[model samples]
Target chain A: MEEVASKVLSTKPTLFSYFRSSASWRVRLVLALKGIEFTYQAVNITKDGGAQQYSEDYAKMNPMNRVPALFIDGKCLGESIAIIEYLEETRPDTRKVFPSDPYLRAKARQLTEIINSGIQPLQNLEVLNKIEDELKGDRKEWAQHFIKKGMNAFEEIIKETRGKYCIGDEVSIADVCLIPQCFAAERFGVDLATFPNIKEIRDSLTGLPEFIAGDLKSQPDYVA
Target chain B: MEEVASKVLSTKPTLFSYFRSSASWRVRLVLALKGIEFTYQAVNITKDGGAQQYSEDYAKMNPMNRVPALFIDGKCLGESIAIIEYLEETRPDTRKVFPSDPYLRAKARQLTEIINSGIQPLQNLEVLNKIEDELKGDRKEWAQHFIKKGMNAFEEIIKETRGKYCIGDEVSIADVCLIPQCFAAERFGVDLATFPNIKEIRDSLTGLPEFIAGDLKSQPDYVA
Candidate 1:
């Protein structure tokens, strides 16, 4: 069994990620939650047509050339939510990140999508950059407007099903998505006071060592 | 076994859906795929401040006031992708919409997210309405720009990993997402010739009886 396992896990997995990407943060959280050992390979996306876009090696790994691509054993996986769910299905014993009950699982995934699809994408670095460059909107104003509107919608959803976490007292995938989005919101100077539930959840999760370890400030690429 | 099964399947499910929402379309696809019958409770989102905003009952089901909320056996589920995944898990035999292999499953999910997070949200009716009402841009030009850009990205992603279907030869959740997005793009006058892979897949799927049955054209509230 050990020999078979060694062959399966032959090559060490490396995560091509950035410190500030919300998508990367979600994958990092999943790695910590699942106790999966992997190397954190940082790609500084702000330099030279973006590191992920220009690097020949990274392009080979992910043709989409997006950050948060996981090179595991010899295969590459892109998309943060998909990568995390892959981990959940394969490593169920490390910790069950998803609820067993289908209804509860749906509720958890719904909240996760609210953050992933609704909030994170609108406030992404690329989108903000586009608005700044193409639309000639002030970067600061564009970030603030999108963040505030997205956070307002997130707050309404959070209020509906939140308990100790984003979904009924469990530290599921929804919490992983929430923290990074809130981090992005704060970076844009969006006030969290108006969203009591969001603030409370963010505060609670930040206190955990697992979440703290996954913070952008603690990543290998952290400048400060 | 029949007694236990009847107890489990006794309750009717409710779905909080909008007349012509792509997200709602995704949930409807899942219901059809799973062979799970549901009560279609329409939330007319274009009249009298939008049914989602004013309907107290709908608000209680999904505080976010988004459509495609599913009430299964008296419990409400929201987020279209999540609801679909929930149906897949509970009714695994009806039609296996997700692959069992973790990596393949992740790829399928990644394709779905590309549609959900990357494409659909940007081209949503509400977002377009807001751009027209608040941003004071030429609505047609803005719509054209976003639809083209988003479809371009979708086409590139699909070209990379698709086979007979989105992920493999089988019909997965990604196909469910792709068809509706293509439907919306055509409505917005996006030139499909530029995206051969997308056009081919869309045309092939649209020809299928299952897809045709689930199409927006077949819905009760379809305008055309």
Candidate 2:
């Protein structure tokens, strides 16, 4: 590692996050599950037109200006799945986010990508606002429409795949992604009742300590 | 593997794809780069409101009902990134989509995720239709806005990282993703001049035979 990179990793790494952002919540759960210590910097994405994230200073760390940028090993990494994979690789001795078998590992990733790429981005706050403002659509209704489509697919896959969690009896990265997405889906008024298979797996995951501590209401930046 | 899945794999693997989908193009590049021969089954995304993909038979094969679903190794995998990773893992001895070094591998995935999750979903035909029909916004304008934002970030990051590809001298997954996205962006009227580094790298990759054969026009489903 470069001297600068080594030094940053040596310190308590900093995580830039928002309290209610599903992407940010996924990262927080990863940090907690891996038992990594980190400082939290709240970038108020909903304030001043989400100005804090787009500021000149913040853009230096993350050009996309998205939250959940983790600074570690001398690099500022953006994208939640990217950051999660980095943590998993660099610290393999820690709790794992994947299975050991390549096929099973691939299956885990397939489930995670279904959310990370498939569902979560569609209902993101920025997209929500764009539709609400430019199209005069109800933001909550727009969110519900997309989330339900995602959950409907998720229900089919998870039914065949779930044992104790999204993959099996163990918690993997897929569960980390599922919890927050399920939370956001319910927040937008999509009844979890629509997805029986997913809701059962989600119910089992929500009570764990790692998940409990990462709850949106428990985060430092949460106002309500 | 199940007996039926094994039988399916015994035949040439099938790619469930669309002629113009950028996500499908990424998978085609990976298949060609690995020298893996596959049969193509086009699921037209623009016909009957994308009804073919959602039909009972197609959904049985892929619950997600998205194109670029790969039938290989006795499994049907949806989501482009997941299929790519599966190919990389199942055939590690083949051409890789990631770097051997862990940190660099993480970086490659970050770039791929930026396109897979960031730009593509926002400009999805479904999302665009929702905006146009419900919000009275121009679909092309919505696509241009999000594509430009993603390309701006991609340009900045690739400037610091590119050599022959999106990482360094070697071709990586990031390159696989960037080439198609740049094409889609240009089609939607985002000027490539604004993203010089990305455009330069994109130009280099497009010349490769692996990419050339996967061009939208080369696919059997292409109209022109």
The best candidate in terms of lDDT:
2
What C-alpha lDDT does candidate 1 achieve relative to the native structure?
A: 0.75
lDDT of 2 at A134: 70
lDDT of 1 by residue, A1-224 (tens): 12222433547677777898889989998898778888777888887769555466665555555778887846778788888888888776898788776777887788788778877766777766755665655666666765676567667776766889877787889889888888777888888998899899989899888898888888998885
lDDT agreement with native, every candidate: 0.75, 0.84
Poorly placed runs, candidate 2 (over 4 Å): A1-10, B1-9
**Residue ranges of candidate 1 with Cα displaced over 4 Å:** A1-10, A54-57, A138-153, A156-160, B1-10, B49-51, B138-161
Candidate 2 chain B lDDT trough over 10 residues, lowest sum: B1-10
TM-score of chain A of each: 0.90, 0.93
- Candidate 2 lDDT, tens digit per residue, B108-165? 8888988999999888788888878877889999999899888888888887778988
Top model number, TM-score = 2
Per-candidate DockQ versus the true complex?
A: 0.47, 0.75
